[model samples]
Target: MTTTASVQVYTTNYCPYCTRAKQLLTKRGIAFEEIDVSNDDEKRAWLVKTTGQRTVPQIFIQGSPIGGSDELHQLDRSGELAKRLAAA
Candidate 1:
């Protein structure tokens, strides 16, 4: 199911998990806004403060922070991802 929800992915260069996360979203036909924080320390700090995660590939679906790559995959496998996306 293609998602109409706003999806934002915070990523950095040289992160394999970030690549995988983007691939999964593409495979699922989900369009997302990719925010590259490779050289943006300010944005990275903001992400850490917002999501409590210091890693790359932090994902937010419909303004709610879901988590990183592993969490994204788990949501997909459990069929929760579609439901989250479909919510108003």
Candidate 2:
């Protein structure tokens, strides 16, 4: 990761938004830990329980939920994602 923020993204292999999210983060030079929960029921369950969202590509920055693909795009568009990613 370029920044000190610990970014974790929960994703499924077949999710297009997951790919987009990764691409956006990579384009911003942000590195993240991607958890592939495609076949892992336990991890998926855990993600849902923690995030309250049963969708793929649940993203976290420094353990703070930043929401999914559209939210990420919105953050990037509003220049907040860069600020957050650049944060410690």
Candidate 3:
């Protein structure tokens, strides 16, 4: 099933990890809303407040934070991400 809410990605332009994370989501055919935090200090601060970490490529699936690129990749490798997407 397709989820009611779209996926979200918080990122910056120069972050390689962010690129990698976007590629993964793209490869899965999952469309997402990307929030670039490079210039917006308030957005960056909100990201930190919501995610509790200072990092690029903070992902959220159905409003739940999935963490950074590494964590997202881990989820993919372990098949959890796939499962979630399929269930959506």
Candidate 4:
């Protein structure tokens, strides 16, 4: 499927969830921008404030926050991820 939505993923170096999330996106042929917050305290704090989640692999689609890996997988399972991406 072709994706028009811009995807951003906030991740950490040692987080397995981050890897899984990226792998899923890759498998689906979805392009994403990965932001590593492993060493940046400012970015991490901003992520927490923006996403309301103190976890790695926070994802955003078309500038809308979409939670983490499990949420992403759930959307995929529910067939909502493509629908969201296809939204203009």
Candidate 2 residues lying further than 4 Å off, grouped into runs, are none
Candidate 4 segments exceeding 4 Å error: none
lDDT of residue 18 for candidate 2 = 98
TM-score of 1: 0.96
What clash count does candidate 3 reach? 1
**Alpha-carbon RMSD to native, per candidate:** 0.8, 1.5, 2.1, 0.8
TM-score of each: 0.96, 0.91, 0.89, 0.96
Q: Each candidate: what lDDT?
A: 0.92, 0.89, 0.87, 0.93
| Candidate 3 lDDT over residue span 40-87, tens digit each | 999999989999999998999888998999998999899898787766
lDDT of 2 at 8: 92
Worst 10 residues of 2 by lDDT: 1-10
Candidate 1 worst ten-residue window by lDDT: 79-88
Note the clash tally of each candidate: 0, 0, 1, 0
- Model 3: which residue pairs collide? 1-88
Query: Comparing 1 and 3 by TM-score, which wins?
Result: 1
lDDT per residue as tens, model 2, 1-88: 3666788989988999999999998887788899999999999888888989999899999998888999999998998987887774
- For residue 59, model 2's alpha carbon misses the true position, in angstroms, by 0.4
* lDDT value, candidate 1, whole model: 0.92
